[model samples]
Target: MAFEMFPTVNKCESIGREKHTVVADMDGTLLIGRSSFPYFALIAFEAGGVLRLFFYVLASPMAALLYYFISESAGIQVLIFAAMAGMKLSSIESVARAVLPKFYAGDLHPETWRVFSSCGRRCVLTANPRVMVEPFLKEFLGADMILGTEIGSYKGRATGLVCKDGVLVGKKKADALKKAFGEEPPEIGLGDRQTDAPFMALCKEGYIVAQNPEVKAVTSEKLPKPIIFHDGRLVQKPTPLMALLIILWIPIGFPLACLRIAAGSLLPMSMVYHAFWALGVRVKVKGTPPPPVRSNSSGVLFICSHRTLLDPIFLSTALRRPIPAVTYSVSRLSEIISPIKTVRLSRDRATDASMIKKLLQQGDLAICPEGTTCREPFLLRFSALFAELTDELVPVAMVNRMSMFHGTTARGWKGMDPFYFFMNPSPAYEVTFLNKLPKELTCGSGNRSSHDVANYIQRVIAATLSYECTSFTRKDKYRALAGNDGTVVEKKHAHLKANKLMGC
Candidate 1:
């Protein structure tokens, strides 16, 4: 759906040149509480055809009664509570892990994704415990830093207690942010509750009140502009809403069905395939080459490029068996309902190696590997974490273009851009599954390290796509270049697209 509230930002204008930061509230701001929480419970309950929800439902009343008694009683209640709490943290986590998938799949607001696509550095400031929200954050929300309550750990299990000074809320949140970023921090903040009022007021550009009316009334005068959510959606005008809804919900299934029949196992990735078709972009498969040799019994490591924000969406729609995408610490904040598994990658050495190794052992490991998105042909250098994987690397190339009606730079490529994609008409994009590179090529042939494998992979990407090879180096520098006229170029492209669609 189109979110009209997000105003268009001109990259060529004065405001686009400035660096903007985003401070977003977790929980209700990014998540639809009852909808997501219970859905996860449902998914976990059904995994492996086991009715976990049936058990949880049967246990909830008793659990609730037990919890109630524990909360009220003085002597025996305390002992009972202590006994229940004694259950290992691992047990609770395991239960949560199983139940989370049901609630989280595709529950995120496109506006939030559009916001992330539109801004620069983003931080999540919340009162919720980090462990309770980590998977949602890591998989979809795209938060760079998780500012929340730190829970106690004993013998590697959660002690079911929050650390004394770690709760991130009220003045404490401001203190935590200042401590981490020093006196200066992000310029924009978003939230839906009164508790977030303080943090949102800290933004130089101001704040966006997410969903509640009561919170908005209180913060309206003291904070930056507050954004409110209505009808389970961002409160945007009607015209744009009609436009986006019309485009996204149109009937384009026949072609998708045809493509699926031809592709077989590859058909489930219909979302990716149909998006290009919807834009009338044609894919001329050169020829059906024999499948590449399978790697050492380990598994497949699907290392792909990040061409547009839709790449993963298409992958999720097409690739069967929940393919988890590896992302930076940032994406976790917005990816609340991501349908599959997601692994967080950190720059910290020990953590990075551990994550890479574990991902290789699981099913296919899907990674952008580029670290950042690029519209140009040259790929950003790949992180060395790829070399740690035991599986063979399958290089996937994503091909896309600026549609005539919709002309704008790609989202999340890098930089502090406030680009809202859903507000405008969307362009067409495509993902092509290319040949896989052997472990030797990805690991290094001879003395070449993983960086060499990265180089070879980048080269293959450049050869297969139509992007400008040198454009990757330009980065945000192009926003000021005299010859770079994105608006004019966009209009011309839009006109061309309209003509092509009409055969005029």
Candidate 2:
């Protein structure tokens, strides 16, 4: 049968399909993109690093030729080999669980999702390697089963070859469905291309998803579970062209990043702001900043919503003065390079409070009470310790934008964060200072509890930044992304002295 003969997915009834079982193709049917190259590039970059990504980009032309002229399975095999060849199986799984979901969530097809999500049981059939797509499909998309090409592995490492059955395309998809359901086929099947026709024909009803570039992606709020925490260095999807550009930029960007870091570290506090602008790091400060307090007067505490490790540095730049900031899990390199004094915080309440109070006595102090950086527009639970220390709290909302590389990572080295952050073509930071807490609202003068004061400041900062407040804390973030509680244990011979610090 001709592909055009099948009805469009939009024509199918989704309102009362909760009892039905639906089988769908992934690349174009469920996701907005038709080509699987970007996802493959992501895996290569995130799991195998820049070299692997370069290899994958180099192999793309061959994949494309095979895809268009030869066969879908042949093209995907090239991508699989280029991206996953010799990569650790564990590394691939880690990326699939922690990194891919955020990207996948951003590209959901609205029309296809309307039908697929409405069904009680959903299955995804794709030519992409199963190891790279299963976690996101099962966990975030509420998929009941995933029928896809399986990658061959040996001793916990990928062989970069498909399993015996090979890439699930054309007749293979129909056979898999038949094996999975026996004589009873799915109640509905949704597909995007002619190759998907074979499997769609096996369903009780089949609908084709027509190519529509104008269709908007389904919002993250519509997903079964929101992507709250994700890990990776890449800020955007790396298509073949983008990947090549990134590989090309690194030679230039690394030195530029080094210069940016050096200038920030060596230049005087007042001169650093101009130096940052000259080097392509933009700092935009808003709101009226209070004048620097005298050494005798207790320093005003700046409570910032954390976006990155550079929050305090940017805050100090905005104020044009070095403010001693208390930090948690900051790398030794970060501390050494920081222009302003960075005091490591001991999780012990009394000691940290005392240290912060001492710093306040010296001058202004900045602290991220969220205890960790959150990339999304959601504020983690504020640590209430800072609220109790003093009533002179100035809530600051921090925002950062990066195009190429994220300045943060949960599964990689922390020292490279500053370099990665600066590697972007024009990374930008906005620091908005909210009103200081009035004496009446403070724990020192008012009857408010420390928790109440913290919550109030959190709300103030969240409102200023247009972010949502979450009860999720630093531990919650690390547990989700890194499989740990965001805690670091100091070694006997470690450079830093803090016994236990929160991981970034």
Overlapping backbone residue pairs in candidate 1 total 38
Residue 38 of model 2, lDDT score: 86
- The TM-scores of all predictions, comma-separated, are 0.36, 0.94
Show where candidate 2 strays beyond 4 Å: 482-504
For all candidates in order, the CA lDDT equals 0.45, 0.86
**What is the RMSD, in Å, between candidate 1 and the native fold over all Cα?**
18.3
Candidate 2 at 317: error in angstroms? 0.9
Candidate 1: where is the Cα deviation over 4 Å? 1-296, 331-333, 402-426, 444-447, 468-504
lDDT of 1: 0.45
Clashing pairs in 2: none
Worst 10 residues of 1 by lDDT: 225-234
Model 2, 1-504: lDDT tens per residue?
A: 667789999899998888899999999989989988889899999998888888888899998999999987898899899999999999998898889988888889999999988999999988888888988898778899999998999999999999999999999998999999999889998999998998999999999999888889999767766676788999988877788999999999999999999999999999999999999999999999989997678889999988889889999999998888898889988988999888899888889889998888888889998887778777777898888888788999899999999998888889999999999999999999888889988898768888778878887787788776766777777777653523222223121321122111
Give residue 415's lDDT in candidate 2 (0 to 100).
92
